[model samples]
Target: MEFKNAKEARQKIREGMWTKPTPGLAYGYTQANLVVLPYKYALDFFIFCQRNTKPCPILDVCEPGKYTPIVTAPTGDIRSDIPKYRIYKNGNLVEEVTDIKKYWSEDLVSFLLGCSFTFEKALEDANIPIRHIEENKNVPMYITNIECKPAGMFNGPMVVSMRPMPKDLVQKAIDVTSRFPQVHGAPIHYGDPKKIGIEDINKPDFGDSVTIKEGEVPVFWACGVTPQAAIMRVKPDFVITHSPGHMFITDIKENDLALF
Candidate 1:
């Protein structure tokens, strides 16, 4: 079935018919990274995200035990709408499941973070080629040396996603993506993967690598998956998040999240 936007994509997930990564499905709607934690840690984690806004941009947060993120999406159930959710117990991923109906709890607090996919369509519209999308590969992501500000139990290196494009088009992509600050806006750095502690440009810590042509430059941007990096270090008793690439599609439009 062909869905028009993220909202529709979310509806399809709610129906249990869609079970793929949410990248090309809702082309223009702003998708978000998911994080669910016990309410005891919500204040600290929310403070962490607020302190490190670039990599962990906040979209909306659901109160304890509530699946709905009232600020951004209306009455949306976080427990069931996403294609996949990763469950962690004491910092170890215990299960990768489609729905968390059995795990839902009043003590859990849901958080929605801005995603980089929300800006890829804009980059595509500007005639800038996104090599990962063309090759049907997951965007390459890395853990950088830069450390994010710690709040209580949260602290880790900044995670970045990379895309290769022509040298001339790099600036165009920068200008295009900079407008969507809500969804990880702007390039943190371009070229020289080693400069950011990335030893192998061809192998990413997360996601698959794509071809880098003779004339293309590897452009890196802060990724929303950063929270996953935090999960390992924070070592909370329980955590629930969307699996890599399988994001929570939202009701918001891509253009709606862009800056004027």
Candidate 2:
């Protein structure tokens, strides 16, 4: 799909012009993971994020009943801007649709979390290859043995995304990505899947795994999926989120998320 600008892309979503994965859109803008819950769960979820800052780093949160994301986006509408959304009923994904107008509720509270896309741009800047992007697939995520610090209703194993790179570029990629703490800063573990409880390097818990070429090491970073894993385990009666790879693009630029 073609978009004159980021706002226009979101407008098209509001008009139902697009309904698919959202990578490669709005080139430099930051795309975010979304989590919407009943107002009754917002406070606990907020604290969950506050405590587990890496995987759940928050960008902005909309007030209950507020469609506008004032901090990261001023004109975008959350209910329709993302390419697709997953609606959960009592913790199970009951539906995956292009928009959530039917699920929109006055009592829903929206939270926007930082995405690895924020740091992928940096990897590209440093000449590090992102295999999933090359293969046109979603970055692979896995539920790890690492546990998030629980807060009220939120508690589960930490989740992470993997990217394979040549041994030489791994350090450079790590140094570059470490500068972007808001979007999962650096590699938590590398080379060995056994260290993180991953039994098979080719098998991932979420998204499609890519080829790891000879001499390349598998690198893992905290993933936005951590919250989704948390949600699925507890099975909340009602929860909503952006479909994987279908993120909400914010007005904020990628460079704005960097720490220098």
Instruction: Give the number of the best model, judged by TM-score.
Output: 1
Q: Tens digit of lDDT per residue, candidate 2, span 1-260?
A: 66756787788877877776666667678888999999999999999999998898999999999888998889989988998888888778789988888888899999999888777767887899989889888888888999999999889999898999998998998899888888878878888988888988888887887999989999998988788888998888899998877889888888888889
* TM-scores for the candidates: 0.96, 0.95
Model 1: per-residue Cα lDDT over 130-200, one tens digit each: 87778877788898887899999889889999989999998888899899888889989999989998999
Model 1 Cα RMSD, Å? Answer: 1.3
TM-score of 2: 0.95
Segments of candidate 1 deviating more than 4 angstroms: none
- Indicate the residue-level lDDT of 29 in model 2: 80
